[model samples]
Target: MTAPSQVDYHDVLQVWREADTIPEIEHAWLFDHLMPIFGDPSGPAYEGWTLLSALAAQTRRLRLGLLVTSNRFRPPAMLAKIAATVDIVSGGRLDFGIGVGSRPSHPLARHEYEAHGLPFHDTAHAVGSLAEACTVIRRLWTEAEPFDFHGTYVQLTGAFGNPKPVQGPHPPILIGGRSAATLRVAAEHADLWNIPGGDIDDVVRRSALLDRYCTEIGRDPASITRSIHLQVSYDQPSITRDAIGEAIDAGFRHIVLGLPAPYPADVTRWVTDELIITSAYYDSPI
Candidate 1:
């Protein structure tokens, strides 16, 4: 994963090039925030889909995804088409991650939303809209005929999603967040669920809750894969190992991490040689 505050496009390409050297690294993601984060409002605000589209041409081996995008950023049908296009460009290496926009409490986030003329509402409303958005996206991806969508937040007439995703009916929909409504939506719809930096015990508790929700919905609990967006980075080698080790112990197979943007390229080799190479001998979590 990458957060592009200090890192420019050149740095991003370099990071991907270094990542290509590490065979154990299966996926790289970008954070999907609209504005400059970490208190750098003047920093270049890299959009997620644009970055993914560019990287699709440059990289070959690793799968690609954004950590999570807000449904409020684009219409569901349009997002579906974009996702399908990107997946096609990447030869079916896409994980469509998304979430409710975010809390309106953050200073930058609030400005980003209101400034863009997007809704700045409560978390509950956003979550409900996100659920509806996912429904529309999935329908567009899978259903061959045009259909109408009437949801609380989005309404469409005769919506169509042509040239379906290369990854069969749809690419993996990775739902973010651990709220009750969010979990229920994930349990019903998501192929994967991402917990963005949380305690292992808390993760375990929520995993159980997800399973219960899946069972309640008559869906297989094991259908949804578990992933974590780890806070550790390549620079802190020991810390990275310890954090990843803990996550592995807690039953997460897919470990997603965003290294600090402008770190030395050799940091990738350092991480691969230490944690990724060692972890290869272990059993798969899923």
Candidate 2:
């Protein structure tokens, strides 16, 4: 995963193109943010979905997407169309990831919404809207006929998606968030659930909560794959390898390694060699 901030497009493309050739690197990701969230506050931050589409067109074998799109960034119906277009562009390699927009606690993230003239709603509103957005998006992808939808957060009339996504039943829905509310939404809508990796105990606890929510909904908890995003450390590969091991032990089969900007030469290759390969070796039974 690369945060499309403080980096050049060519650099991201380079890394992705490299990763595409490496069988160990199964997917690549960009992040959703209109403004720079780290480093120089005013630094350039390319739009995620746009960059994702460009990358999708360029890469062939790697599954790709935003780490998770901010649901608040676009209307659900419109987002469905955009995702479908990307899926077509990528020949169906898109993993549709999304989440309730940034939390108010993160001041940097909060500023992007205000900067873009987008409303910053309360957490409850954001989570509720996200649930509605997921429902509307899935329907748009699968429903053959035009439909009307009236929900607390979404209202659509004669909404329909044409040129539907290449993936049958739509691309896999990967919802990222740690909140219980968001987990409940994932219980119903997400094919995969992702949370940032740092505190392994918290991740395990949340995974349990999600299992409970799925049980309550009469859905199999195992149906949703567990995913984690662990930041890569250029200086210390061992740290990342350890985190990967822990995440794997915690049942997170899908791991997204967040690569920081000013990406080193052959960084993707380095990631495959020093991180992914080593982690696999360490995780294997002796």
Candidate 3:
């Protein structure tokens, strides 16, 4: 098994940045996963794009990105522009996670259409849209001049994205979802696949399936990174250390932890302590 390589923490804005001095923290910053069904509705409506810029400014030496951003929230062209801007702000520290949009009824079974607007929305339609969106994002990033694209869902004539992302070929694209359609899309387009928390058996199974999908699609399975998001509550003093180690042992290249909102001093304390110690531990490798 390939040894896993990283551990990431999510939703770190708990307590709203109150603590003593910010300690040196290492590891990827998994930004907001949701895109505000009610307009950035997570404690005071911090726009995801703005928050990412702030986080990048606040932290140094840590990679930053959204764990996953849904497709429905914005257009691909706009997303590409926003991501490029963030990448520039961070000096190229951004990684992006894209997914088929998720809304209230949670996949919106046809029966739940009434609850949500727009006929419960269709998963296949969303998936197809997301795939096309991915194509658009990449094309816009690489195209030297403003270009034209015509798609079933998106139509752009002479769209020029300026100040392209600092990262060559664009920041890494981490696609999220466990469905076959999602997997297929990732295989064709994504640089990484974000898997949510599950048991070891589940991880192994999903990993294998993803590998197979990549093979079927003529993609090099090794080229794609595997990132998992976990809702972790730690009892141990060195929780982050333990968590990162565990994830690495399980063959994940990247790991994301979902922390509560409101930014607690204790949360910062633990993260700082754990990150400093973990960096030391990994520096020399046991």
Candidate 4:
């Protein structure tokens, strides 16, 4: 009998500390998701795009992204330009996953947002901002060639997008969260949907809801990709299989697994040996 199918193989690039390691890896990988609190507090804070640009030079096949950037961090126009630049440098391998909310608060419940003079305490604003940002981003990417944007929150006049993204329309946009509003945004604008920290039943239910929403909006449900975020520390084969099975069963073709630390050799090897198989599985029929 043929061997069980495999899942796609990719790596997550995170820089817990500055180090000179191998530049290129065996498979496509994501640029580490940067959190403001993850780095030195007193030192200069490095933006996510800057880190991705540097990683682009180091790795060839490795894809890069913010995993999910909070909408409150940067204005839509500024963020669009930054993502475009990364897409160009990475040869269109950049995948941007954005959400309205932020990483859970640490010692305090609201660290990142409050630092920027916003109502960091509210989750509703975060969700709303994410929706507005997604619209602005897609317009910038697919506007009939650099047009004016006059939205309630963002406004631009006769703006022409220069050095457009390498991807045809734009890099793949992944939207996170499972709220009704976020689901609608994913169905309408997002290329992929990411929902993490939920049960299998929850995942299945949410996926069905997304499909229904897509149909309600006259879009082919299959056109929108499904993805999930996972936390994996050990390199056990069983762990890899379980994660891949869970994601596939939930109707997700994309699995974004978080690394406990940045670029661990063991984790990289595990991804190659196990997750790479899944890519072939996707290509071949069951």
Q: Provide the RMSD of all predictions against the true structure, rounded to 1 decimal.
A: 2.0, 2.0, 6.5, 7.2
Scanning candidate 3 in windows of ten residues, the lowest lDDT window is 1-10
Sort by TM-score, best first. Answer: 2, 1, 4, 3
Give the lowest summed-lDDT range of ten residues in model 2: 277-286
lDDT of 4 at 23: 30
Task: Write one digit per residue (lDDT tens) for candidate 4, span 128-161.
Answer: 6677788888777767676776765567777666
Q: Which is the winner by lDDT between candidate 1 and candidate 2?
A: 2
The order by descending lDDT is: 2, 1, 3, 4
Error of 1 at 265 (Å): 2.6
After superposition, candidate 1 runs with Cα above 4 Å error = 279-286
Instruction: List candidate 4 stretches off by more than 4 Å.
Output: 1-46, 103-109, 118-124, 144-146, 235-237, 262-266, 274-286
Local accuracy of candidate 3 as per-residue lDDT tens digits, 70-166: 6766779999998888888888878887888564455322222343343334777788889999999988877898788898878999988888899
TM-score of 2: 0.97
Please identify model 3 stretches exceeding 4 Å from their true place: 1-25, 28-45, 103-120, 236-246, 262-266, 272-286
TM-score of 3: 0.76
Give each model's clash number: 0, 0, 6, 7
Best by lDDT: 2
Which lDDT tens digits does candidate 1 get at residues 204-270? 8888899999999899988998888776555566776777877777767778865775666576676
Model 3 accuracy (lDDT, Cα): 0.65
| Candidate 1, pairs of clashing residues | none
TM-score of 1: 0.93
